[model samples]
Target chain A: MNDRLTAAERVAIARHPQRPNISDYISALFTDFFEQRGDRLMGEDASILGGVALYHGRPVTVIGTRKGKDLEENIHCRFGMPNPEGYRKALRLMRQAEKFRRPVITFIDTGGAYPGLEAEERGQGEAIARNLMEMSRLTVPVIALITGEGNSGGALALAVADRVLMLENAVYAILSPEGFASILWKDAGRSSDACELMKLTAADLKALDVIDEIILEPGGGAHLARAITFRQVDEAISRHLAELSKGKQLGRYQKFRRIGTAVPKKEGQ
Target chain B: MNSIFAKRRARLLAMKSLREHYVPVGSAAVCPRCGKESGHPAVAQNLFVCPLCGYHFPVGAYYRLSITLDHGSFRELYPKLAPQDPLSFPGYRKKLEAAQRKTGLNEAAVSAVGTIDGRRCVVGVLDSRFFLGSMSSAVGEKLTLTIEYAWKNRLPLIVFSASGGARMQEGILSLMQMAKTSAALGRFDQRGLLYISVLTDPTTGGVTASFASLGDVILAEPGALIGFAGPRVIQQTIGETLPEGFQRAEFQMEHGFVDAVVPRNEMRDTLSQLLRLHEKGGPS
Candidate 1:
């Protein structure tokens, strides 16, 4: 524990520009990856990419938040921040997975839900809310992997899964440490302090039971050892999928239902 | 010639004026929107809506229940379920203590079983005075249990939501509340029970994106702020001044997220009418 990276350092590693992203995992782990697009109600949102693919010869629906590998791509992906259509499109894919009796796998890596005027006008809140409600009741196995940053409702919208896993350096938080610092302390520069207090690192979340397991990354970061990181993550997902395929339905609902069962101390104690 | 745009702008102006400070006169009420002074008793008689401008004052959960529920029909649930410092985040325990002392509430939300216009329903209210009505783990648990109770008892559910967002002090655990409550509501929806979510002033962020938006019939109070992101955050992100009445209840209704914008004076009857219409048979 003494030599482990601090939460702030883990945050930086999770957000490293060259870190393995959703597309990398999809290419390495799945075959017959047919990229599906559009919410059908609206146009396409490139930020959230989802479609049908075959994993280990078993057909499954795969969805993930994608950030651009470079600057030009980042602008096109809205820096991995999704709009209403993006969430709607993900929901569309999840429902499709349920209909086809295929398991749903999602990768979460986002700054947050998009905070633009058009997003508000398009009912961003409703779209994400619809996902949380729909994903909870989907009668198919669902799994989520947090490979990088998982921020706020944007990340949780895709994460109401039977099993949630995170990479060693990945950080999943309610909001960025900078945003937390500015909101609470009124100073964004105290982000490192906020990061330490937030407990956003994989080990912290695992201890708190927020996430199920931590997929060990190669020393330094996943970017430094992409092949090994992919193998580790692939094995973790496959193991969880096999365990979840035993037809234990409604565990997705109860898994979340059982979190945070803290009872208050009675008065006059 | 009552154009829709004109009416919308006027409604926005009325809400903007409510943000101004009211004159503090003894035994008298000053209309925050119109700057007109009236007897305190008169304002109370009118249910706290400004007589001159129709601006509605933000009410506490208990006060809301007192007015909305049938007399002597209210029974509280989980009244002692206080929050603990799950993460030991800095300055969080003291903040909780201060909020508890100020709001006289164990948590931001209050859940109960009561009769609305003599019809049995489960009521949950988020008190904005308590940490700006943020959704902490305790708040989330209370509301989830309330929704489950409603489902088990075969009763209607009415939730008045007024929140700033997820409680930042609780960190990631607070964010999970959005999922927890939404999942509970999902199960409730399967029974085809009635869930009428009433959005009051300042419902945004996690609260807006969960049970508040998943209602069978979503209603909002006039001039209430309802959006995914707050106005200040959006303005800062976009570097542009927001349009007038942006994210207000009227704006949400216009954008089709809210069913209607019901004024404070008419909220009870409107909800009663909705509850009655959704009854299995004719109005009880």
Candidate 2:
């Protein structure tokens, strides 16, 4: 039904029901995947999928946000919007990855961090902050890939890395266009105009230097060609991981220390 | 007869709409908390507290600065810098313009340098009326600069936050301020300087998720709503009725997110005490 498409329309395609999510990507890209759970303080957060896996015969840490296609599964994972526990769990896994000297490959695809009262009560802000701090000090290579919706601090919590990649159709935004419309124009129906102005699509992000690379999707969309999409992502990840693992800027907290150190140049200034 | 009655009804409805559009002006000194009418002088003398019920009315940035800082000690910064619609979202500039005019301030937040009880400090307060104190790009950059300014000057930092969270008009650029402010505060953390975050009435969203919650000594005004998510969203998401007093300062204090709940009257003295406790070479 959504035949007419643009970057904003691709947002729908990227979030298609049958799309290959984090689980599919992990299964396609790695072997001997062993899942880990719990933040060791609170309970487990299903929204965050963390584990050790083998990438190209080498041990690596694979972490990503996952959403279920079914309603029960969606509720279980909070529709891939993590709570404080999920961030803590991700931090714990990242620490393990650091200890084992494995490269960090984070696939971000979330509406945003779960904005629930209990999550904040459990120190959601501190949890996200702690991840940013710890990940900065982590003595390993961090590569972030935006496979779907990459919205705000929730996505950024796992996205501070040496290299950030995005899928062609995936959209990375501060807030949804509807949210933008409501706040800016005082009209939620103005989201189409918001989408046009937001510059949140992959190519837009690349133009703004917010993203490093964009992995091209197959014909139609990733959901239409899952195998090809996964293979392309795999190839890009392998290339980056190999380059990052060459022992450059590893450890030393150098990467994140310099985050936002310079003013982003005005587009076409 | 029916047509005449309908026309009369329409006229009455028009008059009603006109009257409803304007709030019936009330007595100037009516207490918001107790509805007890009084004179302006009495309310002013009571430091804007409702004399009958002891309720603290939310104050703007200037009053916040005056009550918290040494008189005549404040020097404003970043007035020249204003927010730009990075995404160029529709009507973003107009909303900012209207908010600026209404608040009589450049942005939601006002960052400055002042002395708190004779000690040099970087002070910033978020004004709730300015776009409901949502953080636009300027707010983020100003706060980040305030932190950096404190770091550069070796001054203690005390921020009074009253926000509904990140501004939405600027889109992801607004969200980027979270990272920008937090990253700056990360470096500020390395300097070993004190950063006291004072949460006022309501602080939520990206603001709470970033520097607002990263304080070395997190304090909140009595009964303020302080959380990442608003209660309604929490209730809707979990499909459960929230417990009474959820997200309030008292609840947060009990849960370890907030260190203490300070009354507005005692805030200045309490902050002085906190600043003294962390004096140079003082006990950790």
Candidate 3:
């Protein structure tokens, strides 16, 4: 409660080393989590972690972008940036969930898809594009939570859900503010300003209707309270799942239809 | 008006018409990448694309529209959807005005309806010369309206994407366009209308994240730099040197990010072929 951080500092805390990752969430919430691998197109990517899991005795498919906590893990996880295979793997997992009529839960925390030549050669854009189109048609309930950095199409690929949630301190943006500053002002040092300008904080996203709900973290942020954060997130997911299950069986496309409509003119140009 | 080279030659020909410059094209100009000096009449004749190395020079939206559509068949839409600096980000208004002056456009992207090879489509092109065709509120609004119009008319839609991503001056307002444009495309998809995205040189950032990457049939011009983050940022983040031609058109196509890599010279024919295949009995 004492650590009142700026938006930029909160962004840093969001990516803090001590923060709980997706694996931690799985261990804390779900049981009998069987890991799934590969998109079955080319090869397996360690960046996307997904599989069948039983959440509160209900069969569910849990998928998300995984960033390793340490250097070796990060390397194994490709620093949380997925190749096309990771997206495809997620898609494959989602389709499986649909066949069994299971609700889908995706944990989005990535700096975006990998921007390497090899990744592009593997169909990164197409993978994301297909997710957007197919996820709209997914017949099962879908929920995405922004646990950390939700950046670009990589984060968005698994984020087309019926109800999108984010941690209070989490940040979801088209790209990192530093990237934005570098592209716009030719200086990455202006990133903090860009961060403020970009309005990437969860509250801002909620205001813009980009997210459905925000789960507040423990005092000082999620890192100071990993167990508590995990429980809060589990509660949020369970609540959203219950709501969506009771709601009519409509495609998630309805969630996006009203977004980004033209705002009323305010006498400016 | 009959030639793609007409506006390109307007400055050089001094009201003499494009024919006067055709003879001198062989030794006239130089390719920036290849550093070869030539008149390049074929380049002008082929939509200002460099003949030797396939370098795509910056093209204004009006000239691009003329080059892509049937002559005298384009009807511009939302030409006056001017932009306002909602955030009042410093110097944005000035830079926007400068871009407008240089490109002779109200915004970075222009929306219009036109007939290409007798197949009517809603078409728009981003002028690379206009703040590098960045997406502002006006740009997104115009494109959204264009998509909506295509949906209403039951027409195929084609857009040329050449942007430096979202307009930084607009801040999150610019980012919202990403969601807005994508949402509109979702509805467009429901209608089963064909939307072709043409990524030219340097399609990156927010633009790549949204509608540019959501095309039903995505196309890119040869040697265009296309991706979400710029090469420099990626390089810094990875601390590794990128491979040669990493984000080029060929690279994107091979990765399945793009459907086809069309050179500017053959874009019209390629688009026409695609249109004819997707056409549902020509307006029934």
TM-score versus the correct structure, for each prediction: 0.93, 0.86, 0.85
Interface RMSD of 2: 5.5
Candidate 3 stretches with Cα past 4 Å from truth are A1-3, A248-254, A263-269, B1-29, B37-46, B51-54, B84-88, B170-176, B214-216, B237-244, B254-259, B281-284
lDDT of 2 by residue, A27-84 (tens): 8999999999999998999999999999999999989999898899998999999999
In model 3, what lDDT does residue A53 have? Answer: 94
Best TM-score among the predictions, by candidate number: 1
- In what order do the candidates fall by TM-score, top score first? 1, 2, 3
Backbone clashes in model 3, listed as residue pairs:
A121-B255, A123-B255, B25-B39, B25-B40, B26-B39, B27-B39, B28-B38, B28-B39
Better of 1 and 3 by TM-score: 1
The window of 10 residues in a row where model 1 chain B has the poorest summed lDDT is B16-25
Write candidate 3's Cα lDDT for B101-197 as tens digits.
7555677877777688888999978876777778777787778778888898898999999998867776656665665577678788989899999
Q: What is the DockQ of each candidate?
A: 0.61, 0.28, 0.23
Candidate 3 is graded, for docking, as: incorrect
User: What C-alpha lDDT values do all the predictions have?
Assistant: 0.88, 0.78, 0.79
Model 1 pairs in collision:
none
Worst ten in a row by lDDT for model 2 chain A = A260-269
Worst window of 10 by summed lDDT in candidate 3 chain B: B13-22
- Model 1 residue runs over 4 Å out of place are A1-3, A248-250, A265-269, B1-32, B35-39
* Residues forming the 10-long window of minimal summed lDDT in candidate 1 chain A: A260-269
